[model samples]
Target: MNSQSPQTVLSGLRPTGRVHLGNYFGAVRNWVRLQEKYRCLYFVADWHALTSDYADPSKIRQATFDAVADWIAAGLDPKRSTIFLQSEVKEHAELHLLLSMITPIPWLERVPSFKDQQQELKDRDLNTFGFLGYPLLQTADVIIYRAHFVPVGEDQASHLELSREIVRRFNNFYGNVFPEPQPLFTETPKVPGLDGRKMSKSYGNTIPLTASADEIRALVMTMFTDPNRIRRQDPGNPDICNLFQFHKLFSDDATIARVDRECRTAQIGCVDDKKLLAEIMVENLRQIRARREEIDRDPSIVWDALREGNRIARQHASETLELVRKAMKIDFPELR
Candidate 1:
């Protein structure tokens, strides 16, 4: 890939299960907008999931399918973006092994997520080689496609920086082969869960993107509103209300204005506000729900998409591996 060409952005999500409102607002929504300007490669990171959930691998297959369906339904056009599965491309493992040789143990140890996850999953034994080497695998995932940009949130900035340092080290010894990938910081929205915590599947507070209108209504109806406003006539704070935060995103200018005015003046009760927000959310996500259902019906079609993506991904990866072999003096002309 030419350095002067349009920047290439690579991002992948682990398919634990269904994508939720946080997933949409925090990442996928930005991804949709990014595709318009940059070359995008989005993949299902099933291999990464194995690092933590190796105990039960059966669920991964279904999770990947669900994740991919959500991706397509969220407006990741197959015609523009290369949507693929990580494990399907064999070269990633190869590149990970090669990169592993050069990466220092200290670098892996310092990754914030490593310790954070270890504490989070204390019941599971995470003291394994795969856990430490996941960052190297991530490095390979990006450079294999020669991606120059990675769309990431603030929490992930360190990973991109580490990948860039690795690229620099490799280039110093083997010549300039891979361009250091830059982090494209995406400003994620504050989409809270029903309990006002960060929306996550583990928390069981997420409103899934695939949620039905009735399900959405039910979830919103149960959401926490302003606690200070004890009475219906008490002046409410929209800023403190999770339902009002959602309205800011899904509701129109007129509706938002109405909510802001009514809430401050104690005209609109929390019940009425929540019901209105639920209706807005259901209407907003209705198209994505319909599209996801349609795509999920045909299993073969999903596989076909994955196969095609694998074909496209392997072409670039193979070329990079061949170059790496040459640089490391592994390829002998006479032997070939």
Candidate 2:
């Protein structure tokens, strides 16, 4: 065994069904790489999913399974990193309830996403207790693992601050039971979908990470290009083209430079450019698709991995809960 003690990192994703390119470049890929360097814990935040979709949670179970499969297919090794469902741990809820007692109501209301999500998801009735306390639950998710770092993009840094504050308050009140987890800011590239908008499932423009080659081709072919360049011979600006943005991610430097020059010189048409991108994307997704297929052939593989992860996660969570209970003088003699 390696003698060096690895720093712990924790991160979770709400089981939102399909994993798309936006999710890959924005977070999941980073999680895969971080696992190689850190003691990582990744979970399907199924309870968090209820913050907004509590009305119809029939899909959460399937979404959790699919999301786990996507994470595995994207190179999150079950052996290297703890992978489990948040709800299965049980300790998270207990910690969340305990933390809620100390958390200020105004702090929950001030979280940026709380209002933003409410306005964005106007159709959903988010004026509920679960939605308000989502950040508190997230705080519990990080601190329960005593994670040293929580990998997040800039948009999520503020949310992590809430976790830090919660930790500070908890330690102040209950006698230093947890560490404040700092944000490990990661570079999350802007991934655009077919309509030249930020890639999102709600937009119906996503190219799912597990999509077949034909599906990839079909989606890529529909991606928006330089709208002003109406003719094949018309000069186009690669900087203004959504397809060019994707090329930057999937194509080599030489291919990108050539595309940039050709598009500007009216030497490459949007149709041909899209076709080239589709081919490269198909090649890129080939290995991931193959792995997903293998996992799909035996569904037990994912479940068994998650079950093992749940056990390991429970062990750590139980230890943390014991400390928490002891700190709060809630560990009754009978229970002990």
TM-scores across all candidates?
Answer: 0.95, 0.97
Name the weakest run of 10 consecutive residues (lDDT summed) in model 2.
1-10
Flag regions of model 2 displaced more than 4 Å. 1-3
Model 1, span 1-336: residue lDDT tens? 565767889999998778898998888999899999998899999999999899899999999988888888889887888889999899999989989888899998888778888887788989999988878888999998889789888877987877898999999989988989999999887889889998888778999998999999988998999989999989999889887889988999999999999999999999998888888888899899999888878766667778888888888789989999888878787976
Model 1 alpha-carbon miss at residue 85, Å: 0.6
In candidate 1, what residue range of length 10 has the lowest lDDT sum? 296-305
lDDT (10s digit) by residue, model 2, range 1-336: 145889899999999887999999998999999998999999999999999998899999999889999899999999999999999999999999999999999999998888888888999888899999999999999989899999888888887888888899999998888878989999898999889988988889999998999999898888889989998899999998998999999999999999999999999999999899999999988999999999899988789889999999999999999999999988898965
Mind sharing the TM-score for model 2?
0.97
Prediction RMSDs, each to the true structure: 1.6, 1.5
Q: What is the lDDT, from 0 to 100, of the residue 43 in candidate 1? A: 93
Clashing residue pairs for model 2: none
